[model samples]
Target: MTFESPSASGLTRRGMLTGAAAIGAGSVGLATAPAAAAPLTARGYRTRVVLAGTAGGPPPQDGRLGICTVVLVEDRAYLVDLGPGAVTAYARAGLTMEQVQSVFITHLHSDHLAEVYNLFWLNYGAPGARGNISRSVGIYGPGPAGSVPQAPGAPVQQPEAPTPGLTDFLRGAVAATAYDLNTRMAESRKPDIWNVLDPHDIELPDIGASATNRAPDMEPFEVMDDGFVRVTAILVDHPPVFPSFAYRFDTADGSVVVSGDTAPSDNLVRLARGADLLVHEVYDHAYFATINPRLAETFSRTHTASDRVGQLASAAGVGTLALSHLVPAGVRDVPDQVWKRHARKSFGGTVVVGRDGDTIGIGGRTK
Candidate 1:
């Protein structure tokens, strides 16, 4: 699907911020979506899943963005990653930024966090956001990414580092946007962006893992509870990127487990035990069987192979397994049948190669 990215003139951010109808019935960008999309179900389910993004990484693509998924529990929505085009995909899914109550980051890689600022930008800027989206939105995720030297003979640079935690990321994002905030604040009607979010650095257990450290034995910990749902975080292996996480959202009606990004993880399997749906990342090694060893090492190091994803889902007893964040995604032209066949090699459960706007209803709604 062709995405019509928003422009400053098309629908004024100022209009949206002031409660004016920033979008019309078929406004471009946020309103009129592409031809690739299908109609949403006429009857809404109590628990549903929206695959907002299915692309794997930083490389720009036409139809997909980086990994992002929105689990709609009843009427509330919670985000797993704010990848590039996240807000665009949300609007394309017939959802507004205001519906997002909290955001959960698996890890702080730029791919996963690309459009986060937009969330803060539009969520707080929308008219009446103060009263409706009034509460501090919860932002949850892993802590620092630990310092690592450039690969051997690489570029002349110091050890790499990312913000220490979600708190720091939010703080830094806000500070970076100070100019915009200050300018907007001149209007007495603006809501303070600082008060719009409640950032929590998920407390890592002393079993020990920090952004920089590794703790292989990941135990599940209940992190935060928005009135509608309770979220659980567990460590997963995305080595070199320590303290990576997989999250589970448990509501009264159903449950969904999101494997943020990882190699096969026992901790992820444990967390997804008896889940209604498992949204995971997958790469097809067969497509790159003879690629450079270094690139191969990178794939083996950070992502779960397609077959292993099936094994993990089957082991965890999830009712449905949906693969998002497809490495080399649709552009590579590896047919869906190929992916489905690869997954069937290991497990025998319902499997799907997820796409941008694909919606699935859990608690027994099948493909």
Candidate 2:
């Protein structure tokens, strides 16, 4: 049986109109009408977590590699993680770097954040390179906030300690790019070279930037002026690496949770509990066990096993479980049916194994 879409969650006509208004401000001058204007019953919002890179064990024929990128689209587009293949994947997904409003990093794992520099440069190089528009894209994630003092058991003194702390590691990169941006602007005689230009050479800044960058720490939690959607972020354990987060997105239509890279944790279960969709990272324990013991050990440390993922979804009673962050063993080999079988043994809900570009429409009846 198919699962009910989030639209089927029972949104009133007024609720739909409210959501539409929330996202409308950004739709000005668009070639096509905004998706939000579509009837809520017609599946107004579409969220896709495009697979940027998928690699573990032996490489695939396409030369892809380890847990990579994903882009989350709502009223505005937000990129979840930017692994190695993110740049290429973004292009493949038909997304221009300028269209992305903010980048929400799950954690600082190289595999997840590798493309940050690429995305930053892409945005920074846009026509209005030095303008507020270029600097408008916000990047949020967990990292050391300040100096680590030598005090014993001293609460690991991270000076600023914001929810998604800013680390110094990225400071140099931003500084290094200054000269290049200046050179490009001077040579082109254009201020916003990196931005997408209209026929008249006018740059189109991401409309969502103003609302999203206003409060970085309060992200996925604060509701935009549109009033149709709200996002909340909760800390989850992905230790050795402290402070990973699971994000929950609530809209007039329904709720969806993105379980960023993390081992099975109660925080995730609670974050996803009762949501219409749970997009989680899953690793193949059985396959890894046979391929390489060391790899298997690493998998255990970094991610949730398939069975454990299933259990979490079942325990949380999510409406649908979409497995993602796949490793080598082909997507079809993911034992999708097994998840359904076991989850049914427990939760008896719909289980979906996410494929690259697979779109799961929420908030509507199965047509």
Candidate 3:
């Protein structure tokens, strides 16, 4: 028997080009763009969401990327997660790669951060289409505490402590590019990327640390407030992957929440309450069993179930519910129609089945 790679979700470079054309002059993606929202005039900027990559994973497959989203606040693009196909989708969304000033990681999962350095590497070029970002780029994530789990019941044989936190991860990223950083500064007369990277390790407030079932919640707090927009992150449970987060962006236009990757989390519901849009991760509950049961089972515990996502949306009272980070979005049997129905069952509000390259404007309440 032979296997074949799945298609790229009916999206292509040409399609991206066309989609970008619609965004020309800072207009929204399609005619359905909200009316009351502020245009990208010199004074104010509206908030829009671009689901750069939508697949959550064991490893990116079926032409789906890991998980990434770009929140556009006026001219600025704030990226969340750095999944595999993120860069491509960023370009597809008509966003300049170099202008990406901040990247917020929900957690330290490989699939979520695999492509960050790739973006930073390009962001540091010698001033051209290859990213000429002038100011420092800020990288933020949870403070020290191994995101991984410890060996069980081995008091004397406990393993060495896990990587400290985002700060240590930042070190690893620099080390991975040490040769390039040194060679560029020493040989090419180019500025080193380290000079422009500002890494901040955020400590969650016990304020939101909902400590349910023994795992400490990641309590919410404002991580970035650059005047144009304020980004807040709340801790959600995705165990053994302690300190997982879900973010909310309150901009001039409206409020938008990105539910990283979590099971049924009260914190997420609380943060997303009354939000204009809720972009939540959802798996096809019916089809999850069809995939590898071991992985499916583990993911089922950590990832949100489809129907519950709908319930969460309803509970949050978000104007719009957009589902992404699909667990098996590409499984032939689990077409979007089948999966959407799962969420729709409980959600009466607007529901959109997310796709890579999909741009959702965050202007006003939907319902």
Writing each residue's lDDT as its tens digit, candidate 2 over 42-98 gives: 234354334434433223423343444443444355566666655554544334544
lDDT of each model, Cα atoms only?
0.71, 0.52, 0.69
Rank ordering of all candidates by TM-score, starting from the highest: 1, 3, 2
Please tell me which model should have the higher lDDT, number 1 or number 3.
1
TM-score of 1: 0.82
lDDT string, candidate 1, 151-179, tens digits:
66776433334336677777778898888
List the pairs of residues colliding in candidate 3.
208-219, 209-219, 218-235
Candidate 2 matches the true fold with a TM-score of 0.65
Candidate 2 has an lDDT of 0.52
Model 1 stretches astray by more than 4 angstroms = 1-42, 128-134, 153-163, 210-213, 290-293, 364-367
Candidate 1 global lDDT: 0.71
Top candidate (TM-score): 1
